[model samples]
Target chain A: MKSHTYTLRVEFGDCDPAQIVWFPNFFRWVDAASRHFFVQCGLPDWKTTERERGILGTPLADTQAKFLRPASYGDVLQIESHVSEWRRRSFVMKHQIRRADVVLVEITEVRVFARRKGDGSDPHAIESVAVPEDWRAMCE
Target chain B: MKSHTYTLRVEFGDCDPAQIVWFPNFFRWVDAASRHFFVQCGLPDWKTTERERGILGTPLADTQAKFLRPASYGDVLQIESHVSEWRRRSFVMKHQIRRADVVLVEITEVRVFARRKGDGSDPHAIESVAVPEDWRAMCE
Candidate 1:
């Protein structure tokens, strides 16, 4: 799988009073990474798909994470993200956070189909729309 | 609506390449707030339920957010969370991230039932075990 790399510097707002990276901050990085990767790779702008679909396009069905080490303030970290599985009804992505030579965190976020066009009642609808061919091609 | 507060410090890990709070980090902060509010108010532990139920306890069903101001590293942000509504098998919660008096971001997270504890396969089950009586009283 082709993993995309995104890097950013830690600012004062990303840490805790302990001066280490706050745990919630990790999800933020993954979110940004996903958005950037999709946008860069050209996939109908995943961010705005919700409006087009008339429903919330992104919904997390499940996620599991492990904290390998503490990320401190002022550190430059890299986030590597890739599709762990791209299924017909849903998709799973894995993200890794690292600094220099060390890995700080690993997270798996599973997203499911929610509110289809015009209605929010569908329970995990297998999207009738196929995953964009160009998007899949980029993963290749 | 009564709101609960959760205080967190920013870590370098939560920032963008520009050292601003990454978007996904907002989810983390709101989640922390949810966990803290539930636990502090004596609600059942989500982790424990997941173990007993063999199902993922909490999943984000829908989330919409607006970024007001950027949060920087080392800033202490307070997250205020409150239940917007409690309906059959679903609920809405509102969150605001603030640095002292300034609002950094606002979000609405809607969560629904993933599976039933008795049988994890019945994804159709949509029910909340009634907010504990004590929790209702506390909220009242």
Candidate 2:
């Protein structure tokens, strides 16, 4: 029921040659918003979780986004993110990018709580784990 | 039917605190791969197209990605991108992120050839235009 809003200012580097905010930059902001939602809900950092239970962080399994309007440099956008669902080993995060009263983009992502396959040395080896009850409780 | 492969070496900044390639960075690479596909196909940059026909760039209308494996700094990735379909005002691009022969991620995007609206002054005013025949020919 609770949501977190992350504010960001579009920078020159964030735009493309067309002088509009590149679409990928929206994803960057969304990823940050996802993390901010958990942090705002008082969950421990990923490092602490990894140390305690081998949970590295939330990695996306599936992601979809729709772009409605264009944004350019100097624009300030707010991304509101919240948890929409929690599965056995995954959760869905929903984000809406807005400027004032206008919604510019919408995104929904399915992410899993992952852990290192071995000792975390092999960068490519990681697997998802069951949803942590404490994490779910804190987020919800 | 021709596909373009964009090779990139993952950098330190491209990763997140978890020391893995951030999901957003994948989108960034995908954007570049999209442009690279056009350039490799002999089309001019977006600026030229904008000046010639009010075509700014291919802006994403919808995108979906599935992450199959994780990548980290110092890894090398090759994104093979090609236009899979050409619609009236939009096109679909398919991209596969690979390392050597291993598939790391897959993404498909619906993008439009967009132009500035209302004399190009208002940053938020932009809309998709019909796919240019010349542009499509070059890409195909």
Candidate 3:
């Protein structure tokens, strides 16, 4: 599959008192990278998807990450994201965060396309939908 | 081992365009819960640890999280955190986030006590140290 790269600069606020990027910030960046991948793949934004297709967004089911090296503020990082696997109702996204040639963190997430539950139950409830063929074709 | 519960109110900014809590914020909360657990266990703050014992902080080596349910703004959430296992140099911290009686997310992190490399290498470099017996005793 084709991969997309998202570049970002680590801000001072992103770092913990220990002077290294707080681990949670890595998740935030990867989440952004995941969205950027879809955008770069010619998929519409979540707002557009919701209006046109009732697809609210891709929500994470699970995620795993390995922090190889610590990154500090003032560092420039690149996150390379791609879909590694696809299921009926879920897909796996792999992201590698790198500083130059060195990998700082590696992350994988299982995510599902979700929409509002239409069963007249809880209005805020959401349910996953099957992988959209068009979306998959664009990503792949 | 004893567990600690940290409570916080979800704010509007934590939500995404779908009006649900963005997944990364769950990680941020759990990381705070991890620190709160240590504080409640009678362990000194990271600054004190670094000054007194050369122990900087617990840095994550790896982590996994499962998102069970989605939460939104105005929800009051509780994160329960504890150390689940201890290795020679690394320990596992587990966290569960709940809204009322419903579990929203579960997280497990493998972390190590880190300290600055004293040798004349990169000043920003850190190395893992063996789990401190006193700190482990305090937590247990």
Candidate 2: CAPRI quality band: high
Worst 10 residues of 3 chain B by lDDT: B116-125
- What TM-score does chain A of each model score against the native chain A? 0.79, 0.97, 0.95
| Runs in model 2 lying further than 4 Å from the true structure | none
Q: In model 2, what are the clashing residue pairs, if there are any?
A: none
Candidate 3 C-alpha lDDT tens digits along A19-114: 889888898899899989999999999989988989988999999999999998889999999999999999999999999999999999999999
> In model 2, how large is the Cα lDDT of residue B84?
98
lDDT of 2 at B53: 86
Model 3 lDDT, residue A102, Cα: 97
Best by DockQ: 2
| Worst window of 10 by summed lDDT in candidate 2 chain A | A116-125
Cα lDDT tens digits for candidate 1, A1-140:
76789999988788644345655667767877876766666655533665675333444545666665566667899999888888875678888888988887787776543344334342223233445555567765
Task: Please provide, for model 2 over A1-140, each residue's C-alpha lDDT reduced to its tens digit, 9 standing for 90 to 100.
Answer: 88999999999999877888988789888988998898899988898988988887899998999998888898889999999999999999999999888999999999999988876688788899999898899888
Candidate 3: where is the Cα deviation over 4 Å?
A: A119-124, B119-123
DockQ of 1: 0.07
